[model samples]
Structure formats: C-alpha cells, structure tokens
Target: MPVTDVTTDPENLTMTIVADFAAPVERVWSAYSDPRQLERFWGPPGWPATFTAWDHTVGGRAYYSLTGPRGERSSGSWEFLSIDAPHSFEVLDSFVDDEGKPLEGFAPMRMKLSFTPTAEGTRMIGESHFDSVEALNQVVAMGVIEGTKMAMAQLDAVLQDLREFAQGKGTQVELLDDTHVRITRLVEGPRELVWRAYNEEELMRQWMLGPEGWEMTECVIATEPGQQHRTSWAPVGDTPGEPFGFEGEVLLVDAPRRAVTTERMQGTDGPETLNDLNLYEEDGATLITVLIEYPDKETRDMILATGMAEGMEASYTRLEHEVLAPAERS
Candidate 1:
C-alpha cells in the first residue's frame, strides 16, 4: 500500500491523503498527466475509469467515468485552476452527470495535489477542501478514504513498468468505444514545438507527409474556433496514389495544448468526425493524444481498416527525425 495516512478535519472541512512512490517525481506526474496511465489506477478495483476528455492546462477540464462490475457508471469532472508541472496542481472536483454537467445539490470540492522528491522516491500529497462539515463527512461515509487507498495501491504496478509509457513506442491506437478511438504517439520534442508542427504550415510540410512517396500539396490552418482548415496530399514522382484531402471547422482551440475540430473528406457530404487533440510533455518528450469520434461504428471500422494507424506511425517517425531533432540541434 503506497498510502501512508488519511485524515479528515471537521473544523477545517478538509480531507488529506499522503502516499509515497518508488519513482521519480516526473514519472509519477506523467502517470497523472497521461489519461491512459491515469485511468489504470484512478478508480478502485472493479470500478475502472475511462477519461473521455483530458485537457491538461490551466482553465481546462477533464471528464471521466468509472464503471462498476454491474455496468453502472459514476461520472466526475475536474476543472483545473492552477498547474505547475512535476510539482503541484489545483482543481475544482465535482460529481457530474452522464453529459458531464455537475449534479444538482452536490457542491464541488477544491482539491490540490502536490508531488515532491523523497529519499526513497516521490511523495504525493492530496488535499480536498469542502464547503461544509457535512460535505466532508458525507464523502467519508461514502467510502472515499477506503476507495482512495484501493486506487493508489494499484499505482505501484503502473510505476514499475516505466518503459511501456515512455518514448519510442510508435503510434498506438485504442478503441475507446463504438464511435470513439484514441491515437497516441510520444515524440522527442517540447510540447510547444510539437503543437506548432501541427499548426504552422511551413513546419507541417516538412514532417506531416505519410510514408516516403508523398508530399503535402496544400495546408490551411485554423487559428480559432468556427474557422475552417484544409490539408491535401499528393503522391510525388513515380508513387502510385491519387490526391486526397481533409477539411474541417475548428470547434475549440487552446493553443500549444489542445484543439478540437470536426473533420470530413474535403468534398464529401456523407459524415464528419470530431478530433480532440491534446499535448503533454514529460522529461522533454511530448505525448500527443488524439481522440476521434466517428459518426458511427461502421465509419470507425472503415477508417481503421485503411491502414490509418500505419500511416500515422510513418508520419510520427518523420516528425521526430526530421522536424524535432533538427529544431533541438539548432
């Protein structure tokens, strides 16, 4: 058990938990920053969590749900107030509904999490402040303390397998649901640089091309919400492939961290997909996660069958070798 102590104060209307881990502060922080590793231990035992949206930035929000053995779901959300990488973050935590809205009559709690280096490894401190004594007691009666211990106990196994979450794992895909798919790739670069590579036309042209025989013919970026963006690619020289393109309207844009867009074939009126892009950096490497929501399961299956993951891996390899490495050298 990593949890050393759990305490509650009626006078202060706060609850605190202290846990220690046998890993560096950065590694421990990465577990929380990346939704994949986070979901592994965020819920207790049979109640595994699934993060549908994660925006790891100040003023951002994260939405997740825990599924019970009987298929029942409990939803929650966190509104980030402040963040200092590898150190501390503060959020307003609330019990939400299926649609992610806070449940009526349940007040949100202000929670602060801090990570520090210890002689053995890292010590994590979590403090949750409630609005009233009833609020604190209510959650305690709901088994918050016991549930938390069970959750943190699972973290040790996650921290031990470091390589699985680190860089050099090529582009990976996760079938999140019938219509949702998540694609992740860790590139050796800073978050800002990687974000720019996706937004800046000149930089994108250098590494966004998939495989060896293609070239980007046109690139249009959307800098803000509601704006449209388009990108087209064509095979070069003797390469045998037809030209193709994608066009989308930007739904949300939190520069250098997250972006949400609706994408579809350039000239097709068939269907559209929502693409939610997120970037998080740990130890100088950026983890790029794109959660795509297709119109249906058929569309999701059709797209994955087209070797999309392979093409994405090829592009990510080029991104690190051609764009990020050169930027680091310069």
Candidate 2:
C-alpha cells in the first residue's frame, strides 16, 4: 500500500477514494477481471470474501459474500453498467440476501473505478455515488472508510504475490552527469492526458504536493515560452506547517508532446535547474521522459539528499491515479 486517500462529499452524495499500488495498470485491472483475485481483497481484514457467478463484462452480474470474524455473513452483488478494459468500469453495487436476492430497503449505488499507470506504479481511483446524503452517511457510519482502508492494504499483499509470480518493475532514474539527471517511466494513459496532468494547475494540485500531508495551495502555470510558472505548497491536516515555493519560466510548449522550463526554489541560494518533459504515445500508453539540469553538482547532490526524489515519485503516482486515470477513462 503506497498510499490511500479517502474523501466524502455529503453535498454531492459521493465518496471518492484514491489508492496507489506497486504494480502495473494491467495487473491491477486483472484483480477485478479475475474472480479469484477479486475475492482475495474484496473484503477488509478479518473478513474473508467468497465469490459466485462472477463476470467482468458490461451488463454482467457478480455475486459475492463476506464472512465476518463472528461468523456473520453479508452478501452483495454488482450489475456491471459499463466496462473498458485496463482503464475503467462502472457498476451498480447493492446488498443482497443469501439466496442472491436484493435486500429490501437497502439502496443500490453506482461506482466508477479508474486505473492509471505512473512512473512508480498504478493508481486506482474509485468514486461511489449514492442517491442521497442520508444514504451516503449511512454507509460511512457503517465503517466503510476504515473497511476500505483495510481492504486496500490487503490488496498490497495480493500485488506482492502477483509480482513474485512475474518479477520486475518502475521508474528509471539516471545521473546523466554531475549536474544533470534523467528520469524515465512508462505511463499507462493517453499522451494528451499525461500532458494536461503536467501542465494544468488543477491537475497538478492533485499530484504535485511534494510530500504526504502537503497540499498545493497555489499554482499558476503558463505553458508558453517566457511565461510565468509558479507553484506553492503548504502543510495540511496534522502535518507540520513548513511551506515551499517554486518560480519557473517556460522555455518551450508543445501540446500533448513536450515542454521545457527552468525552475528556481524560493529561499534557496542554490543553482536553478532546467526541466524538460517529453511524452510519447503508442496504443493509448504514454512514455514520460524528464531531464533536469542543475547549475552545479553540489547543488544537485544536496537537493537529492532532501529525499525530493521520493516525494516526486509519490506525486507522480497520485497524478496517475487521481488526474490522468480519470481523464483517460472519461
């Protein structure tokens, strides 16, 4: 479990969850496509799930039941509304009785799941919509959030097994020179979506936060030569209140393909860096190539020591799951 973030919007009657995994988009999607894989993590910790009549196509139906620690059983069914292989799927989820009949008085909800590939791994974003705030609150009050977290954690174990079954993985970071570094990764989404995730302020806000509990409070990106590209981040929630800012100048802008810029960290006396992003697409997948050039070797080494690379990897993972994934599905 790299990270999982859950947010509920009572006003919109929706609950959205974002999760990242150290696996490819295809692997993640396979978990749902295959009944055995889905059963392994469909329920939270301490609740083992069993599936019956499983299907992974549009208009198909799946039936499953989870046995609780105390021998309690809860059954459910999903009516697949739509399916897009390796990208997204929509379904109507509902509670059911032991005989596979819908439980009376319980509301059925719509859920959409999207998968995107990032430099580090794949991201899964699940959006569940209810008919009313009361319905939404009812489910949350039943421990859906905590249960979801546990279930997602279990998914990581499943991914580990899958990884062992077929070894390998992730972003390639190379020190091209003392003052230059190049990072490359195969991103599993459309080229246009990848470009927008890199350039759009709203999209950047989703994944560009430097670290956990850090939020991008301000961003103004002008993706044209000689334009301003400034962004700022601040601590959020229980996070420490240290803030950081970056001021950059765009040197080149190429829609859905490449972009070049130069950045300087605010309050730092170190040398500025030149950043270049190149996107290549084939069969709906994009390859992201990033090259960064620092003014001096010492400056680059010092920045790396701050664990900036790890933060960057996390951000890129979030970008894939929250922004790029949803965009590609849409």
lDDT of 1 by residue, 15-125 (tens): 999999999999999998899899878987546688999999999999999865334689999999999998999999999999998898788999999999999999999
Count of backbone collisions in candidate 1 = 0
Q: Candidate 1: minimum summed lDDT over ten consecutive residues — where?
A: 160-169
Worst lDDT window (10 residues) for model 2?
161-170
Output the number of the lDDT-best candidate: 1
The whole-model lDDT of each prediction reads 0.87, 0.78
TM-score of each: 0.60, 0.49
- Model 2, C-alpha of 266: deviation from truth (Å): 66
Q: How many backbone clashes does candidate 2 have?
A: 0
Residue-pair clashes per prediction, in order, are 0, 0
RMSD of each: 10.2, 20.9
Best by TM-score: 1
